[model samples]
Target chain A: MAKGRELKGRIKSVENTRKITRTMEMVAASKMKRATDRVAAARPYALALGDVLARLVRPDIAERFPLLRQPATTTRVALVLLTANRGLCGAFNTNLIREARARIAELEAKGATVELHVVGKKGIGFFKYLGRNLASERIDITDRPSAADAASLIDGLTDRFAKGDLDAVYVTYAKFKSALSTPPSTEQVVPVVPPATQGTPRDFLLSPNADVIVEALLPAYVRNMVYRALVETVAGEQSARRTAMKNATDNASDMLTLLKRTYNSARQAQITQEIAEIVGGASALQG
Target chain B: MAGALQVSVISPEQVLYEGTATSVTAPAFDGELGILPLHAPLMTLLGTGTLRVESSEGLKRFHVAGGFLQVVDDTVRVVTEEASLVG
Candidate 1:
């Protein structure tokens, strides 16, 4: 009886866990759809921007643009580590943190002072635990990151880079390739690197001339890069959460099945033992 | 269709319009610029104002701010980060 009762309690607990996981999986699935749509929706702008840049920027034209000027020697750098605030999502946060740590290590080894600017509470907590110095910590941006949110995150940093206070800035995030694969990658955001001019350049009537336009466009370009990274990181987070919840639900179901089988056998054995005791007592009374 | 230009109004969040337009009037940084078919390759920074596109369906207007416009051959692209449809 004791064994049977204990098994029943175990089964009930597993059932509750299964319910929670199932709900989480469904929630994550819906969120993933929206996040992926954002990814697609943002593509046209990126393409059009790239189209304009490729046609507009050249080595000679970019030479005068401060943002496009690559630092001769990278001495001071800033790294923005993006992680999800909550932790239910598998290794999503872990992978990003690991990647950021390695990047900081690599930069420091090269005699560059790495300034750690972290977003999301999970990353902040991890760094705080290690007593690492953080230039800034922000937990305001959620899974749905807006352009304004991105601007707030990168504006000050870019201004510093332009003024030569910082040599370079890099962002570390999970690159969403697909639902099945999201690898943590680091991308340089400052000292804006223009894509190599492709094909033959077209000569167009420049509106405010090339110099001013390129200067303004480079900052926008940097903001776009940061925005894109945020969007992709969000998508990857949701996908990872869904997969993790799905696995959890499956495991819970399996555990419940095993517990039920053991409970049934324990109940049957107790019934047989009681019957045997009754028969023995009756035989002794008759003798 | 001979004189129609292929036009696309693109914003960061979504594509506002994509069709053939007879004419397009964009608010360039300095002033308003109009385009017809076979316009020479041109690029300009956009200011905050109305963007009017006239097509077979009728005229489509958008309020766009702080972006750029490009025209090459018969293709025109109006890309703005902040844009919304207007009556």
Candidate 2:
């Protein structure tokens, strides 16, 4: 009887845990949908920006823009590492940190001085524990990132790059390929790589000139790139979290089932013992 | 549709407007520039001011800041950093 009672307690606790995991799974699923929608909504602006850039980035025209000027040699580089502030998202932060560390090592191997700018609480904590120097640490910008947020981050980086203080700027984050896949990747943000000309260039009347327009456009372009990275990283975080929560919920369900089976068997054993005791008493009384 | 130009106003967050407009007046870096149908292909830096789009329905104005305006093939695309409807 005691064993049956203990089994019932175990089952009840497992059922309570299952309820919590189920709720978490639902919450993550909803958040993932919203994040994915944000990613989709931001696509047209990026494409439009790309279209404008493609038309303006001829070799001769690009030479006039300081943002397009490649450094003579890469001496110093900045790596902006993006991770999540919260960490229930299984291996998401871990994979990103590992990838960032590898990139830093590679950059160091090439003799470039790397300035680490971390953008999440988890990344900051890990690096701090490792006693690594951080150029800047930010944990404020949450899931919903605005254009101003991107502009703020780009302002300092672009100023330094324009002033020749930094040779190159690279951003590392998880690129949202799909809901199921997010791969850690890095892209160079400075010395803007002009996309190849697609078709015949149209003769557009430049207001001031291509050079002046490009001068204004490059900064905006850099900000947009940073914004894209931030949004994609958020989407990836949600996706990772949804997957983790789903697995957790599933595990909880399995545990509950196993516990229920064990409880039933314990109850059956208790009942059998009770019946056996009653039968022995009857036989002894008859004797 | 022949007289109207297809206009898309897009920001980093959302597509504020996408439709046909008979005319568009945007704030260029220097001053306000008005674009009508069959205008030449043009590219100009945008400034912070109201972007007015007039169609058969009515005139819609958006407070736009810091981006670019591109006109090609009777299609005008205004890509701004931020755009919101003026109250």
Candidate 3:
């Protein structure tokens, strides 16, 4: 009876856990859909921007823009680390932090002073535990990153780089490849590189001329890149949470099955022992 | 068909319009820019204002803010930070 009671308690607890995980899985799935759609929505703009940038970055035009100028010496750099605000999403944050640490090490090894700008609570906590100094900490933008959020996030970094205070600017984030795969990636976002174009150059009616437009476009381009990263990171986090919750739910189901079998056998054994005791008493009384 | 340009007005969130238009006018950073069919290749920064597309179906307008406009080979591409149709 005691054994049966203990098993019952365990089964109840496991059942409760199963319910919680199942609900979390559903929530994550819905969030994943929204995040994925956001990423998809931003793609057209990114592609169009890329097309325009390819044409705008002529050699002469490229030379005039400050963003297009590569520093003579890469002495100072900034790393914008994007991670999840909350935990329970498998290795999503861990991988990003690891990637960031490695990048910092690499940059430091090359004699460049690396400034750490961390986004998300998990990254902030991890770095704090490690006693690492953070240039800035942002904890609010992980759940719903708007265009304004992206613009403000990179505004300071862009300004510093333009003023030659920071030589290079890099963003480390999890790039959403698919539902099952997201790899942490580091990209140099500043010193705007002219993406290669395939066709011959065509003359354009210069409205305020190409040089002026290029200068304005460069900042917008940086803002868009940051926005893309934020969107991708959000999508990746949702997918990771969905997968993690799904695994947890499946494991809970398996545990429930094993517990049910144990409970049934324990009850059966107790009943059989009670029957044997009753028979033994009757037989002794008759003798 | 003779005086129409392929116009695509794109925002970060979605593509507002993608079709043929007789003329397209957008708010450039410096001022307003007007485009017609066979317009030479042009690239300019956009400002916060109204974007009017003169299509055969009638006139459609959108409030656009902060982006760039590119015209290449009779195709006009308007990429903006934000865009919404004007009621």
lDDT of 1 at B75: 92
Per-residue lDDT of A151-229 in model 3, one digit per residue for the tens? 9999899998888899999999999899899999999999777778867877777677767777777887888889989
Q: After superposition, how far is residue A277 of candidate 3 from its true place, in Å?
A: 1.7
Give the per-residue Cα lDDT of candidate 3 at A46: 83
Alpha-carbon deviation at A101 in model 1, angstroms: 0.4
Q: TM-score per candidate, in order?
A: 0.95, 0.97, 0.95
Give me the runs in candidate 1 sitting further than 4 Å from their true place: A278-287, B1-3
Q: What is the per-residue lDDT of model 2 for residues A1-287, given as tens digits with 9 covering 90 to 100? A: 78778878887887888788778778878888988888898999988887888988888876677789899999899999999999889999999999999999999999999999999999999999999999999999899988888888878988999899999999999999998999999999998987666767899999888888888888888888899999999999988988888888888789888888888888888789889999999999999
lDDT, candidate 3, B32-74, per-residue tens? 8899888777888889999999998999999998888888888
Q: Chain A alone, TM-score for each of the models?
A: 0.95, 0.96, 0.97
Chain B TM-score against the true chain B, each candidate: 0.95, 0.95, 0.95
Which portions of model 2 show Cα errors greater than 4 Å? Answer: none
Clashing residue pairs found in predicted model 3: A204-B41
lDDT of 2 by residue, B1-87 (tens): 357899999999989999999999999989999999899999998889999999888999999988899998889999998899875
Best by TM-score: 2
Tens-place lDDT digits, model 1, residues A72-117: 9999999999999888999999999999999999999999999999
Decreasing DockQ order of the candidates: 2, 1, 3
Best by DockQ: 2
Model 3 lDDT, residue A21, Cα = 85
